[model samples]
Target chain A: MGKKVLIIDDSSTMRKIVTRSLRQAGLDFDTILEAGDGQEALQLLAKESVDIILSDINMPNMDGIEFLRQKSANAAIKSIPVVMITTEAGADILAEAKSLGAKGSIKKPFTPEQVSEVLGGLM
Target chain B: MSWETHIADATVEIFSTMLMMEVSSQPPLTERIKSHQDSVTGMVGMAGLYKGMLAIHAPSQVAMTITGNFLGLEVDSVNDDVKDAMGELANMLAGSIKAKLSDNSKDIQLSIPSAVCGDSYSLDYQPQQGSSMVPFESAGGRFLVELQLEQQT
Candidate 1:
């Protein structure tokens, strides 16, 4: 079975773009789910089984760092790998995300090659 | 590269690679008027080692074109897609620049992006440290990206 990927971002346009890029990067995934924010993503995680997550840092209800913190503490979903895709280019933000157990990160305006490289061996 | 070069590179990269539009940026301007009667403004705030704002302003028609290209749809008006796309563009630009500025230290925090659209409006920004505006032309339409930075007090 192919991997099940989940994408979380506030912008629907971004979600579409990331989805397209994932496919272009040659990651075979049977299911690709999406959420508008961390809260919505948690809701989806409770009801579904996702293998990997691609998330955005800044969001309305709950941000990616908080989501990572919550997910890290939950045994039911703690093992899933999260890759942050965001425009928050600060080193502090990146360190926080890493401390919260983010497996990797890809900055905004990324290319397919970069996505593929980051997802290497993770998927 | 300088901050202005970074902004120009990010703008060109985003539009060319993601939106598949060719962007031509003019020389950076130290002083310029940004607001327009019918324009879309996307803004993102930064706080930490540096505090200021980054914004992208484009005429409504230009914004619609960019949004349409981003979403692969035919956009004709200022809708949610236009606002969201512009905000995301600003977010991306801010992040890219922040990364360049924060290479050695972890001292930047980015705020969530916000967008506004109007038929007529004015923006009054008094930068305490530094600021620049760069105009870009793409697909026959023009837009401007502005960056302002100041040391946090």
Candidate 2:
């Protein structure tokens, strides 16, 4: 079976950028899914199965931290690994995300090499 | 160094890394330019330990060029994509400034990003503490990045 990936962010522009970056990084996924926010991502998760997830920390409705919290509680989607791609680079928030079972992170204004370096192992 | 240095470094880094464009920062402006014409302004607010706003103002054509570089497409108008791209730039710039202000992420809270655009408009802000506006030159044109900050007790 081909691998699938999910990307969650509030900005449609950012979603498109992430999709482009993924292609540039050579991280090929047979299927690529998108969600506007954590709530939307959770709803999408209930219906679709993805091997990994890339998300943004700040968003409307449901942020990434809360999404991680909610995703952990659901047995069906708990196992899917999540990597945050956000403007936030503070130790506190990133640490909290790590505690919540995030696999890794890629900071905003990041390069394709940075994306590949962090997500290469996760994939 | 100073806030000016931070703003310059952050803006340059973002444009270079994300936009794949090189931008050179000019000396800081002595006075803030409140009124804009044929331009788009993207901004974000910060509150808590420090209260402030970070904004990026660009001409319509320059903004379209930026959006084009960002998405690898030709954007001829200042549409939703231009607004979102500019807002995201402000968000990223604010995040960099926030990191410099405090180590704790909760120490400061950032509002959702917003954008304004038109043939003519003015942003009215009376900052109680400090303010700085830096101009940058890109291949397409020039833009300004403004920071208005006041430390809270």
Candidate 3:
């Protein structure tokens, strides 16, 4: 068993690419669950435990920041490492995400190697 | 230098590297407006030092093909993976173009990539009338690259 990974994003395409990148990088996972937004992710997290999370910033129901805030409030969820894969690279936003307990960050248009390097170190 | 020529250079490099296609010519606007364009397009905007977007407009089939190749998968339909790949391509290309333009303009900030998909769409910059439109045909399908901008004169 590699690890249980949770992917949060509004776009299914993005989730798939991240998933594909993980597989391509040979990161094995026993389970992979996806949510359309932060609230959905929270619901999933309430029931199951995951080792890592790969999330996007912009979303409808709830965004990555909200997700991180909520995660931080919950002791059990807060402990799991989070890797934010979003297009927002603004320094303020990056600093906020860092403060919210994100394990690391990767910008858009990332390659498998890039994804590997970010999460590989954390996980 | 004209916006048309600059767009051509950017398109050439993006088409070759990202799409793995070659641009034999920088087709005219009339020819571009006339192509059987894809209905859905993924568009991204920029501002500051460098501006404009890298739009990937493709028909349903073509979009799927490009997305599939990008993810190194065999996709038969439009999925989250496909859209993400298209959006990310726009980001990558825009980033690359920003890098290339660094030789001329070094201090530009890039906005996060945004996307829009529909039957038909158009992307343009303000300071109207001057724009560069580059059309390309790849194994996946035909697409266009436009570099619309306003240089402080």
Candidate 4:
């Protein structure tokens, strides 16, 4: 896997936890980026290249769904895999995310093992 | 959905999924959990369809343990991890109750969950036109999630 990750979430707590888990899972990356919302994430994406995107579905300003939608529309950013991390497991949101081209999803309250398991396939 | 059922489901799910622990709500004789001098809790209150507050109250020790386990950190102090987990749990429980109680939640909205924890605390919530208190307990500590739903109908 390449050595860059983009973490997009409104919650700083969640962002830190995911970053810790990423390290614990042994996914060494030279660069790890943070964005509070999809709009900020898109802005970061425009300026840099990242191998993977870890995002949350619910956020203020712009949610992950809108982020994925806009990213999918843009050919330049479409190929990067976006993995969703969320507490919401409703079928509708899951279907919508997948249809929008999300590579995978990890539900909230997740464990280190679960994080590793999901990221293994993508990374 | 009644307060009894909501409390039962929320406690069960949170323990089962988050902590990887199983807890059985003891009888009424079970102690009502009140944390130590300074502690933290996350709460989310609903005002529309349901007029109630859901809170996750835990002692500093318990909060640290829960946070460390959830975040995979060797945490020693109560931080954002504890606050967010408690707040998020309230959100999940409320959402679950909403899904169970209503056909559509277009009319109902939820306030964001927040944290409040300290040595001295007092909450004077005048009983809504009609509302009830629903408490939840996990293996480590106990917290109460109340429901005052005379508005949903």
Winning model by TM-score = 2
Ranking by lDDT: 2, 1, 4, 3
Collision pairs in model 2: none
Expressed as tens digits, the lDDT of each residue in B61-92 for candidate 4 is 76776666655568876677777766766666
Chain B TM-score in each of the candidates: 0.93, 0.98, 0.73, 0.77
Q: Residue B49 in candidate 1 has what lDDT?
A: 86
Cα lDDT tens digits, model 1, A1-123, are 677999999988899899888889998889999999999999999999999999998898999999999999999999999999987756677798999989999988888889999998697
In terms of DockQ, which candidate is strongest?
2
- The Cα error of candidate 1 at residue A6, in Å, is 1.1
Ranking by TM-score: 2, 1, 4, 3
lDDT against the true structure, each candidate:
0.88, 0.93, 0.69, 0.72
Give the CAPRI rating of model 2. Answer: high
Q: Which tens-of-lDDT digit does each residue in A39-80 have in candidate 4?
A: 999999999999999998867789889999999999999999
In terms of lDDT, model 4 sits at: 0.72
Among all windows of 10 consecutive residues in model 3 chain B, the one with the lowest summed lDDT is B30-39
Candidate 2 TM-score over all chains jointly: 0.98
Clashing pairs in 4: B37-B119
DockQ score of the complex predicted as candidate 4:
0.26
TM-scores across all candidates? 0.91, 0.98, 0.70, 0.73
- lDDT, candidate 3, residue A27? 89
Highest lDDT scorer: 2
Query: Which scores greater on DockQ, model 2 or model 3?
Result: 2
DockQ of 1: 0.60
Task: Kindly indicate the candidate among 2 and 4 with the higher DockQ.
Answer: 2
